[model samples]
Target: MKPSETVLEIDLKALEHNYRYLASKVDDNVKKLAVIKAFAYGSDSVALAKKLESLGVDYFAVAYTQEGIDLRNGGITQPILVLHPQSTHFQEIIDQCLTPSIYSEFVLNHFIASAEANQQKNYPIHLKLNTGLNRLGFDPKEVPMIVEKLKQTSSIKVDGIFSHFAASEDVKEKEFTHHQMDTFKKVSDQLIENLGYRPLRHLCNTSGILNYPEAHLDMVRTGIGLYGYGNSKEVDQQLIPIGTLKTIISQIHNIKKGESVGYNRMFNASKDTKTATLPLGHADGINRIYGKQNTNVSIHGNLAPIIGNVCMDMIMVDITGIDCEEGDEVILFGKDKSAEVFAHNAGTISYELITSISQRVKRKIIP
Candidate 1:
């Protein structure tokens, strides 16, 4: 029997399956860094990190310093790379033994000062290269200046040099992707020569690991793939989505023709209709875009279209022909019920859908 309340079931077995599948694609020599940022893409980050640690994952990464601190508090002893560290939390980062990705000259200088003030020597840091992302990273032309600063500071050491792909998943952007890769390699090589030592080189993201095998380098970072999405239908087949969102029909309503339902009468019944109300709504991450029959939920193995405007805590689905009643199990997205499909119907993606799941929803981990 399914739980009465809205619940997100995180399946560890499926997570392991996805991990093993991705690991199989890489060589034994290359290290695998699991991207656990955004609460592991909106699933339990600490829980998932611990599981990946036990599986011998080489490293873990998070977006912010607090996220890394949370993992440390949760007993994740694995090395965590704070992808976007702020100057204010530099001391906390060092105290917690978390590595910071030094992206720009400002970040680099600030981290050095913090490490020195703490009397730390040879603190590990990763240099972020721009490589066409145009987001956060040092331009390739800045390699000389970056190395000069590194020489002046003994407080921090270059542990790794990495960059993000602009579009590894799209074959149409192959030229741009390769240019990014080549630029990373050239800049990395230049930095290595200037520093007189080779740090770990990692540039491939999830799609890069699959599409551009040669660029796997010394390590690869994967986020979406680990959560069972390959960014494409063909690749997604080889992965298993780990999070299953389920809820129950809170109430059922029968309306006659010419009756209207929900806020502002957004859904008007032209014929007699039966509707099932679910406990989850936009507050739980089912965006308002999914309402008005844009998507559906699985009830009694029947697809029921969501009707009317989605409320803050509820959504009504048309279940006129479905064999379901109040309190019946509702599968929002899981197993054969694809989250990708659910998100695409509303001009979104699984990453947003899964990560947007409100923390208030009950989480049940299937170990």
Candidate 2:
């Protein structure tokens, strides 16, 4: 409630709804793992994870060791999987009872050594097989060796095996997704057979859970969808966005024709118009791309186009001929039809749009 400060409202009911919907997609054989990484994709991880925990999420997934530690520090009892494991934090990881996704032999060996040094026994670790993303995880050829290495470690436990799908919403490119699933399954089978371990096998993400029933092996990790941002237009239509970014219109002014606004004179009023500057800009996670073509806001339920380069703490929207005044409500992003719509206008994804929202914006859970 300070000037230039912003607030984001998260709907817990909508989050619960998204979870139940994704859960409905899972076959009876598959468990649900809620992806609470990146601060629940920038929407208060602790609050959201606590809610998902209460909603019966079978597991929790984070991108790093620190994220898992944050959840543990917050008193989360559900199993937390760190999708990306760092060798340096293996000690804290073991000390905190965090489950890490072991990808490379180097990191795996380090984890093994750390576990042994700490006198750990049967510590659970997830195996990530790199099917296609090429970003992280082990190659299929390395699975057998990984299995062999794991068998040599007494203090570590291979609790789960999984992979990430690059594309699942594009029904037209089902081949790519199918290939990823098939490859992951083959590697997982090889790993388990070679090591004689069957911990828990999982491969589907949010989009993957909706489109590929067979890929939901053992557990399904729901991230954006759990936060109510389905990747595709069709799937996105099925759910309500849970977060809404709002700020006050700090001031309004009339700019004559040819008058410039904001920095660099990037936007000029083509016609005499009324503009309102709201307390949100790139500094608050409204990316600069939303400045011209992608910017739009809701005022009195009517959408207005953004008129200038987004300043550090403010943006100008043409409210020409609209009823507006200072201290009025302005929806910068989230549940407002404008934000997601603007993302498409800027040729970007909803995850970038929502998660990019700055933490300075007070995030509150709506009961």
Candidate 3:
């Protein structure tokens, strides 16, 4: 396959390694749900899901129903959980055999009605309780009401119950995280007692898996961590980043002192400097804020500070004093230059940095 000027290289071996490493952290009975939402966080969902499914991933998750549809179309047979399914897509969800995380009374009832209308029997569904995040899911106090409604519905079946942690990654929020766990347990217990059976219970996300092993209930869902980041320096060292963004130097120029480079004169060379322009910019996931002293790219194992405003499809970097020339491989983020570090320099998180990579960028899987 021909390489594009800019490419997002996905190392399948590293991805599989990260999955095994994370799986090792959990109990044998606990299932693993690989979160492949946002196109596997912009790493090609179908390919990643296929690999994970083959590796014995018990389940997969996506943020939307369409993503689950895409997976189904891609020949993915593993169970898929739709995190935030809407009422409009309930029929299609059932048709595609995609389970939904029903959060609200309205969503639950609507889904039940849809199932009944379709003459569906024991259609799998997951209940999302709002322990503390408050983004989605039913409030803990609503468990009794939810239980009553489930009793009335014979069309849908509760396959699992879960909640999201707002700050499981922050040690400072330990108290809050525990409170969420406690609330989830209480709510899940009530539901189980009322239903006379227990559904699969899960609450831990990526950080929750590493920080709170005790909270890895019946199953754990991980998105960012599976892609080779542990949300912190200590754990990150144990994981290998599976995705590497690389590009080649398109052109090089020798800038004389006092000469400006790139748009709006954001960079004015004080001394003669060598500048290299890379075929990557904001449109390619390199945010404009990373330009003009904010971020640097790795070239020949050295730092090449990005100079001037990052353009839509190009960025100029100061390559002075570096042994580099046109066509040299430049690493935006990978082994030598961590995505976490690059995102930190741009005042964001690795999630945003990696997921922001444009779909137009070619993705090559390294077998």
lDDT of 3 by residue, 28-48 (tens): 999999999999998999999
Best by TM-score: 1
lDDT of 1 by residue, 179-211 (tens): 998899899999998998889999998999999
Among all windows of 10 consecutive residues in model 3, the one with the lowest summed lDDT is 1-10
Candidate 3 overall Cα lDDT vs. reference? 0.92
Error of 2 at 247 (Å): 0.8
Candidate 1 weakest ten by summed lDDT? 139-148
The lDDT values for all models are 0.93, 0.83, 0.92
Residue-level error in angstroms, candidate 1, position 165: 0.5
How big is the positional error of residue 21 in model 2, measured in Å on the Cα after superposition? 0.7
Off by over 4 Å in 1: none
For candidate 1, give the lDDT of residue 359: 93
Candidate order by lDDT, decreasing, is: 1, 3, 2
Clashing pairs in 1: none
- For residues 112-198, write the lDDT of model 2, one tens digit per residue: 889889888888988888999888899888866786787787888889988888878788879999899889878888877876668
